[model samples]
Target: MAIQPDSAPSELAVAEALKALGPPGLLTGCRRIRGGDEQFLLPAERDSMATRDRKARAASGAGRRIVHELLRRLRCEDVAVLRGPLGSPMWPPGIVGSIAHDEELAVAAVAMRSPSVRSVGVDVEPMLPLPPDLRAVVITSHDRLGNLDQGIGGRLLFAAKEAVYKASFPLDGRMLEFDDISVDLKSGEAATSSGRRLLVRCTARPRILALAYTP
Candidate 1:
């Protein structure tokens, strides 16, 4: 069972926005975080998250709940998504997936193993402008925003880079600096310092969400 959001815009709205960006063979799920979500964590999951405070566990538990449900749909139920190398999620064999959350939302994206797709990543952010000071740390000259509204572009760019980082790490096993990659919103792609290329997609409805995956 999935955790339901306490209020609108509905959780279905968030899931639809994410699903619209996914390609064939990709599965996505989402839900609003609720109080006591941390109770959903399995023993191993809770052990792995031992150091996290209550709020972090709640967010992670919500994300894991979605991950488990997505895996079940993929015919790989009862799987544990542990924090693995570089602190990225380690999925069951033959799966490439990602999970992310903002203060109020959690999302998961999963896809069966495929020669054409190597890794996947997803990120969500509140539908608000990115703070100006932080923009300098995230936006680089190599990045392109296309024609997105200036107000939302900066925040979207931030989310895109985050998604790309999560997707890039599993393949290269390298942590990335924000400048280590460049995003092109018009074409919906990103290029990492390690030469990994990812397809990126974004949606502002319900909330701001970004997904990145190998093509």
Candidate 2:
């Protein structure tokens, strides 16, 4: 079942999109983009809030709350997620997950507790083109998968890279530039030029949602 936020009609659409992309064990949460309203942080999480600007505070708090809610459902409790040096959410021992939001939406995915799954990542972005200069900076020769659908190329690549970054960081820990990964739209996979691959499932309608997972 989808975890729906209060009074947000668009969340229904977001939930449907999530269902299409999220695998069986993925836990999801959705809310209208807002700031400073989440109230579920534990003491340590509260202390870490000192550094975030309002927008960051709200989004991170909401994302963590979603993660905690999922954890509680699995009978895990009292664990507080913190941000690591690379800015990814730090899950409790033996847990792995990802979080993402834009100015209008917030969603998170947590892998149900298990030993085999290595990492999980989920990102949400509006279906809009990157600005021209940003487009130049984010697109690279490797990402130009020939004959990929041109209409959604820019937006698709950007979302794919983000999902790849979130999915890979738990293990790689290196900050990756957009060029560090190349995406093959035809195969629905993103790969490092050196060949590390993450399976990417993207929903391009209504919005863009990408979920990446590694074994």
Candidate 3:
């Protein structure tokens, strides 16, 4: 279930979110990076924003800054933020990572000591009602099995696909469609028919979150 923005925030909330992250061992010496909203206001981010887009840009920039600073604290230097071939954010060499942000929340995962961790992708989307019309395009016929009537189920499917796209691009350098990956809406999980498994998680409220890692 997704956490409602209206609810009171607490340490338990953070822990609950982390718990949904699946096995920490899968991450192997991985660390969680947390940052407040202020970190997104860097000059570079500000410069890229349109005058009317300042608010949204600032929020996003602060989230990225928070994650970047957390990386620095982990001793990741020469931190260059580049764009991948698909235009997703790229990390410096020797780093595998995933990032998620929604409203006031942003979180990132980094593997500091894992040599085998190669491709990584993370995505965060708010828990809310999705348009009914687009569901067909995003949710394939295969995904319609098992409780497709629920709105939360649909959101999870959408989020899993987004995460798969993020994680797969670095490995295949190709754009993937919702149909390319099959999602189990009931479990809030996804897997590529080729054998890649992504752990999909969601809060009861409506947010869809996922992370994919390739060794």
Candidate 4:
């Protein structure tokens, strides 16, 4: 939920905003982390996250709940969504999606297999500015935020890069670092050193949400 004791109102608001921001043909959902989301995990999903701390598992479950729900929309019902190598979710066959969460919120997006859209990634962050200390590491020289919301520009860039990494890694197993990707906020695009390019869209409303997709 936005990380407050009484955040349900804004939590829902964030969810709606994220749904609206989703890329075309991508199903998106959000969850307010209630700290009991682990209870929603299935046996196989639970086993995959067994080694995580209580809070991590709960958060992971929250994300998976949205993932599962989205998958169902695509007719991929009851998939386990296991945590595979490098911590990425092993999505069901004929589908590609990504899930991410902030402290009190979880968001996911799913899309059916198609030649036009190979993979998708979605990330959420509380509507807060990225810490100044970490700016040096997160912002690349090629990145631009001109005319974008300056208040949370750094935070938005961070989310965009993270989304790009998630979307690109599946296309090629190439690992990426912060500087390995460049986000052009003004153009609503991102590129990775591994030669993958994605259209990135973001909104800073009840939260900072970013989605990256290859089409």
Maximum-TM-score candidate? 1
Q: Which parts of model 2 have CA positions greater than 4 angstroms off?
A: 50-52, 113-116, 144-151
| Candidate 1 colliding pairs | none
Q: 1-215, model 2: which lDDT tens digit per residue?
A: 56766676787788678767766766777766566645656778867655647777777777776777777866678788877665778887777788898887878787664544577778888887666777787788776545655446677778878988888887777678888988776577787654667787787776888877775
- Expressed as tens digits, the lDDT of each residue in 138-205 for candidate 3 is 77777743744546666666766776777667667776777788867556556775667665544443
In model 4, pairs of residues that clash are 1-104
The CA lDDT of each predicted structure is 0.85, 0.74, 0.55, 0.82
Give me the runs in candidate 3 sitting further than 4 Å from their true place: 1-16, 25-52, 113-117, 185-189, 193-197
Residue by residue across 1-215, what tens digits does model 1's lDDT show?
A: 22234356668788878888877788888878888888877787777665568888899998888888778888897877887645688888899999999998888888897866688889999999888898889889999988876568989999999999988887888889989999998899899988889999988777899999897
Q: Is candidate 2 or candidate 4 better by TM-score?
A: 4
Candidate 3: residue 13 Cα off by (Å): 1.8
**Sort by lDDT, top down from the best:** 1, 4, 2, 3
lDDT of 4 at 56: 86
TM for candidate 1 is 0.93
Tens digits of per-residue lDDT for model 4, 1-215: 11112246766677678667665677777778877888878899888764768888889888877777777777777889998868888987778989999898888888886876799888888778788776788886889987755448999999999999999988888889999999998889889987788999888887889988898
- The local lDDT score (0 to 100) that residue 192 gets in candidate 4 is 91
Backbone collisions counted per model: 0, 0, 10, 1
Off by over 4 Å in 4: 1-7, 148-151
Cα deviation in Å at residue 203, candidate 3? 3.8
